[model samples]
Target: MGAAWLGRRLDRTIHAISYDSPEDPLGRRVVVRAIERITGQPRLQRIYEAYLAARRDGDNLWQMAAEYLNLTVRYDPAALAAIPRTGPLIVVANHPYGAPDGIALGYITSQVRSDFKVMAHAVLERAEALRPYLIPINFDPTAEALRANIEAKRAALAHLAEGGAIIIYPGGGVSTAPHVFGRATDLPWKRFVGRLITTTHATVVPIFFEGQASWVFHLVSRFSETLRQAMLMREVAARIGAEITAHIGAPIPFSDLTSWTDRQALLDYLRSTVYGLDPAPQRRAA
Candidate 1:
């Protein structure tokens, strides 16, 4: 049965039993006993309660993070206002910083539309603390837990299919690098996002963030690169101060010509747009 259906049935059954005649203390006791029996474990009731509480906590943290970041989103107000009503826009942005970037973008999207989701990394998803607010994308091939990742990806696709907006960091984990500090040279363009937009026929909105993290974090990033394990770099970057200002570009319509070549062209277009907006560096690289 579907989760929504099961939840409805559970709610209806509980309400029916609890409200039945109101005077029968025996009926209320029976309802409690039924719940214990249905759950099949004495500990399950506590677990369920704890899970709900954790979900609320996760949501609260997400809200607080959004407030803390306070991203100055520079876009045409008319365009921003049109996005929620337009349905299922694919928000593409340059990944800067580790924690605040996604949080700020997600918050901005939420302000525009209620039906929005974020495609986050598997590590963040695995934290039971954050799982309630994050839909983890499993990129690992060796683990059997990837089934959840598959389900999450399907959920994202279904949300888009139903005309819901989604925020994705196409640069993946590398954008979280600390050394990226307003530097124009390190941006790595990945092709998966282009494929997603073309396959889903969603309009692409490019966003750019104009800052990065501290040098200590960059040292950790360098260490990870040397060890050939870059995933941990995001966590390192998050530890230090990483602030960014986000800028949204004009939307690109999906079409038949959005092949790999087209994807590269789009990436180039976005890169050039961001590069042009970046201030002239105080000093040129040696």
Candidate 2:
């Protein structure tokens, strides 16, 4: 195995040891106190306390999942500020690095907008660490679970109706392509993002992350992608060594969504407008 892989194994072992020990009450207390001192924000401190309480209340699984991943976010403040200040915006981005990406984006959006909430997977919603900011949009694995899926969608729509800022990964869970950067071809099929924007009259902010997680993590990421066909396992891979760098593109106004029937046209418009691409020549239908 490579040195990086070995290092990752060591890190996981350390975390497992620390986490599995049931007699570390004092140690846990000290760590929590240290976090409180470092953050110095009463609200955030309260959230941390709630996380501990939730963990003790049989929510340890989600806490462990969150700790096993890491995130590194980068965005231009000037560019972010230039975007129009519209209430109830839907922030959409390519799915990269699984839950860590959501947590990082959640934290950043929480900092930028007081009413920020994420339309996240139900598994992610189970996380005590992220529950404060995430609003679960459950995705059922069975074709027979369409009703449940519709309920989740309705809840998301209601949240937007309430003037809440939402973060959505339109590609769902399949867009976290491992290895390489700037491979735009890997993006998944566009879905209800445009319709959601059009119906809700919410502005769409397209974001791009320029970097992905470490290669070792990518190995495991691909494994999970194949075995479970879900990207949840990327969180485990990230604990070893995986980082992400984000780029926040400009926002698109809701009024410019006339060609709702044309998927490629809508996608191209989003890419060009948000990522600052020169307009492509209109394609004739083959």
Candidate 3:
């Protein structure tokens, strides 16, 4: 049920992120056809319906995501406990695993901090179960999308200013080019984190959990991005006892980044800090 719903929403919002305009009906249909061909609408519907039923019966989305993906989530309680429980907190993480990553991240954080909300794309933001925990963001660059962005910014800033904890996937979209950084890495970290910190003076906590998408997901990216995303369930279903790990680092106060002159530099610094926790070459390969 949930899958069917989010799938439809993704079809509609494709233009919101892509070059096409939301008002163009023709563009919408094209996007749907392209994606459906890749994901197979019939299979997508069956998977979503079953997932939705399970989701409705439980308050734990993390477990649902893990079970659906066939993954075993593992995190260090001591590492999570090491985070300072003071001031407004902002978690900056790599957007590798896309949807499942958010669920696991939210689940881990909620265990330590209850006042948690994620800055998510408009699609995930629409999930009724996740509505309470999401601050919706439109990826379009239109005047309307710009207005929507401003509102999202306002809401996120307000939430932080109020000492609430929020999680942000700075990469915005999931990682596409695997060879860009010698491994799968996000496109580019958005400057929103810098802006958020400057305004709210929130403590930025960086964590790294490599994306677990299958090679097929990455290989197919060479063709169509829309179809690649539409077929994420194939990646999800590949995880059987696969371990998802997160390494949390100490907080970096907003003031600490004041000396970083360039905006992109700051974003890079944050991305590297998170990537710093990535498993060393041998371990990752082994």
Candidate 4:
């Protein structure tokens, strides 16, 4: 990958390393390399290598990601069975552990419906293996990101119109600690998800991933969004061999969603409904 690509994807200043320059003044290369090492980028790179290796061995990205972490997922059987076998379906979930939750939902839903796509961060599209399954949305603030997002929305709408399923985490970003010592909760969700539901008349199924990333992640997130993004892969690596519990809620038909005139209000209700499935006692208060 090019230096610009690395800088964008990894959220580190990789461009500081002047590969073509014979005399590197300002020691910027040293500072950037130190930042990468401190953020565990080398270890994350190794993990990405294993992920690509899995693809070479004929595994899909979701399956490979789950296997790399040895992640075991348990879903509510009754709720899972409630999903309509054929129709436009939207699987909404709380954003807890970033890749783990997305990969888990993708792996589980794929078993039920082969024609499904996930609305995911554009950075994941770099995997190449995941492009078929991902409808990428660039979260970065580049001039091109808005255009890409609009195209992604059009693609998602078309996919649903064709009676395909979609998986989305309404919270545009990961859950974070409300305060220094508070429980983690999702950032305010966007209204576009509700609009999508209304437009497609898709059946809404909620999934609650039962845990958050390491406390250190939440703490780091309180400081810088860029640093938080850089830390995500390392957090995933920390959960190697972890058993992840995901709770599926009863499917809310489009009929039930019609009462709310305001899409943002509807989105809020859906957010609360998903969080309601969290087993943690004080989650509602958060």
Question: Which candidate ranks first by TM-score, i.e. highest?
Answer: 4
Candidate 4 stretches with Cα past 4 Å from truth are 1-41, 54-60
Residue runs of model 1 more than 4 Å from their true location after superposition: 1-62, 68-79, 82-84, 126-133, 141-151, 174-187, 225-243, 255-262, 270-286
Largest lDDT belongs to which candidate? 4
Where does candidate 2 clash, by residue pair? none
Ten contiguous residues minimizing lDDT sum, candidate 1: 15-24
Q: Comparing candidate 1 with candidate 4, which one achieves the higher lDDT?
A: 4
The whole-model lDDT of each prediction reads 0.54, 0.53, 0.69, 0.75
Give TM per candidate.
0.61, 0.61, 0.78, 0.84
RMSD of 1: 14.4
Model 4: per-residue Cα lDDT at residue 246: 87
Tell me the alpha-carbon RMSD of every candidate.
14.4, 11.8, 5.9, 5.4
**Worst ten in a row by lDDT for model 3:** 15-24
Per-residue alpha-carbon lDDT of candidate 3 for residues 1-286, written as tens digits (9 for 90 to 100):
8656755665565521122223334444466446554444444345556777766553566666566656666777788887656569999888666766776788778777777788887755434566888888887557987898889889999988888998999888766655423357777778877888777878888988865566666777767665565555445444445777787877888779888877778888888888887767542321
Error of 3 at 192 (Å): 1.5
